[model samples]
Target: MVAFALAAVFFLALCLSAREDRRRFRNAVLFGLTFISLSVALLLQLDKVPNWVAYPIVLAVFAVPTLGTLALGVFLIGNGVTMVRKEGRRPANLLSMLAGLGIFGMIALLMVVQMAGSRVLDGIVGTLAVIVAYISFLFLCFLGYAFLYGRIRVRGDVDHVVMLGSGLIGGDRVPPLLASRLRKGQDIYEAQLARGGRPPVLLPSGGKGSDEKVAEARAMADWLIAQGVPAEHITLEDRSTTTEENMLFSREIMTADDPGYRCVVVTNNFHAFRAAMMARKAGVNGQVLGSPTAKYYWPSATIREFVAVFWEHRAVNLGICGLLIALGTAATLTT
Candidate 1:
């Protein structure tokens, strides 16, 4: 009952928060609460089941961590291969692979310590385990909520469909990643038109890079025009390099045309939540929409986005990490 109550409260809070502002940390908090509630409910139900059934359930619960770790490691390694083959061999592309290797290394080291019968090593491992658990819990919260947030549907009429930009290929050509955003924005426009509403303007948002011969926004606009979208309906926000600037500069154009403008910002699925948060911060009065990305490419890209989010809130993250370490150390000493 207590667990269910907590679940209800959290769900209500999630509804309120999502309605008020879907692009905040409260979404993560509500998700964590819901997970905890469901876990407690499952445990309670298991306690009433027959021993034969309950025992296997308990065993499965205990086995999940090991199975999940193994599966994640394998997936990351495979994703790394795909990234290299499809994208490039840059250091940024190696994150998923390196993370997979690190997980196995940590497990191996812990197993070695368990066999060596060294009290000091055990103590160190115990402390490290707690810190790792804390970080892992936070990462789970982020991953789960981001996935949910990206699935939200933007309804009603929109004034603009803003497509955030990525780097161009060959100094001016639209890359697959950026092309995906453009297509999504175009889809939103078509959807509105089909609903008998006004066809929204498409805003391709990005500035020129040092290596690029033209502004990314202009290139994106050209790509959209080539796709059969009318040239008159495209607005080029060609002065913003970063995501923050993408939202801000685009908002300027949106507001200039219609002060009460509503829009949907489009990006790849993995980047949707973070970009929505940036849009909220920049006071862009719109939701975010996501286009499909390659399955194998998602892990590394999601990790890169997660790292950016962590760094963006580093002070709070670092403080929580420091507290977790201190608590872990104290627990280790006591035991």
Candidate 2:
């Protein structure tokens, strides 16, 4: 009953926090806690249930982690191979494959430690296991919350639809990835107009890269213009070199015109949540929307995004990991 009550509290907190500000990373933590507390409450009541129900639950509790990890490892490995073949040999493209291989490697290490029975090996494996578990939990929280955040609709009318830019192909042409963002932004703008709301400004935000012939925002603006967006409605912000910059510079332009402007920032689906976090940090009054991404590319890209988010919060993450390691080491030594 106490566990169930705890879960209820966590759920309520999660709902309130998410409602108050969907961009907060704390919302993800609350969401994860709600799920975990509920799971624990369920497991605690298993003993009072019928044997048939309890048996399957017991089997699942033990079997799911191993089986799920194996399945995930295989899927990521396959996706990684596809990414390498279809995308290229870039390090970014190899993330999924490397993560998959790391899973397998950990499993093998566990097996070897079981056979060796060395105290040192046990301590090392235990430390690694705890760290991995912490990271995996955080990743699950991020993945689940990101999915939920993506589904949320923009409330009321927005004054601008800011489409974030990706690198151009041929140093001038907008690639399919970036084109998707422009299309989504246009759709939002048209939808607002069709609904009898004011037509929002279309703001394409990015800068020229050393390898690019023209600024990314300029290329994106040209694409939008060709698609029939009015020159008067288009605002180009061609100074941002990163996602944080995209939000900050776009905020400056929007706020300059109307200090209390509301807007939506657009990026690829894999990047939407992190971009939202950046928007909040930049003091932008906006929600973020995601454009569709290629199916084959999403896993690696999503992993890359998670890595960035993890590093962004590295101080707390590393502290927790270090504590877990110390505890694991102490336990192993004492035994």
Candidate 3:
């Protein structure tokens, strides 16, 4: 009953946090707590069931996480190889592969420690394990909440659909990734019109890269025009470089056009939640929508997103990690 009550409290906190601002990282943590508490409550009640059912449940509880971790490690390694082949050898592309290898390395380290029986090594492993567990928990929370956030639709009419820009291919052409965002933005504009609402202005937000012949917004604007969107409906925000700039500069443009304006920002699905968080911080009067991304690219991209979020709140995250490590070290010494 205490576990059940804790789950309910976490669920209520999650609801309130999401209601206040769906983009909050706190919502993700609360969501994770709710899920964990509920799982614990259910597991605690397993004793009431028949031995036959309880046995399987107990076996699954122990077996699934181990099996799942191994499976995930393999999958990430495979996807990483595919990413390198299909994409490029950029460091970003290597994240999934490195993560997969890291998992196996940790597993090996655990085995080695167990065999060697060194107290110092045991303490170190224990500290690392707790840190890894904390990070993994946070990653799962971010992933689950991001999926939920992507599904949420913008309510009422929006005055602008801001498509955040990515790097152009060949220094002048829209890459498939940026094109996806543009298409999603166009669809939103068309949907509003189809629903008998006024068509929202399309804002392609990106500045020129050093190697690019033109600003990204110009390339995106050309793409939108070629797709049959009216030239008049397209606004070029050709000054912002980063994602934060994308939100802030676009907000400036939208606010200049209409102080009372509402808008929807668009980015790739993996980037959507982080962009939404940035948009909120930038005081953009809007929510963000995610366009589809390639399947093989998602894990690495999502990991990158999580890393960025983790760094954005590094003070708190690092403090907790340090605290955990200290406690683990103390406990090991005592033991």
List of clashing residue pairs for candidate 3 = none
Instruction: Write candidate 1's Cα lDDT for 262-308 as tens digits.
Output: 99999999999899899999999998888999888889988898888
**Distance from true position, residue 203, model 2, in Å?**
0.3
Residue 63 in model 2: shift from native, Å? 3.0
- Tens digit per residue, CA lDDT, model 3, 1-335: 66599899999999998989898889999999998888788789897889888887767767877898999999999999999999999999999999999899999999999999999899999899889999999999999999999999887789999999989988989999999999999999999999999999999999999999999999999999999999999999999989999998999999999999999999999999999899999999989999999999999999999999999999999999989988988988898
| Ten-residue region with minimum lDDT total, candidate 3 | 56-65
**Candidate 3 residue-wise lDDT at 213:** 91
lDDT of each: 0.87, 0.93, 0.94
Candidate 2 clash pair list: none
Tell me the tens digit of each residue's lDDT in model 2 across 141-182.
999999999997897789999999989999999999999999
What TM-score does model 3 achieve against the real structure?
0.97
Clashes in candidate 2: how many? 0
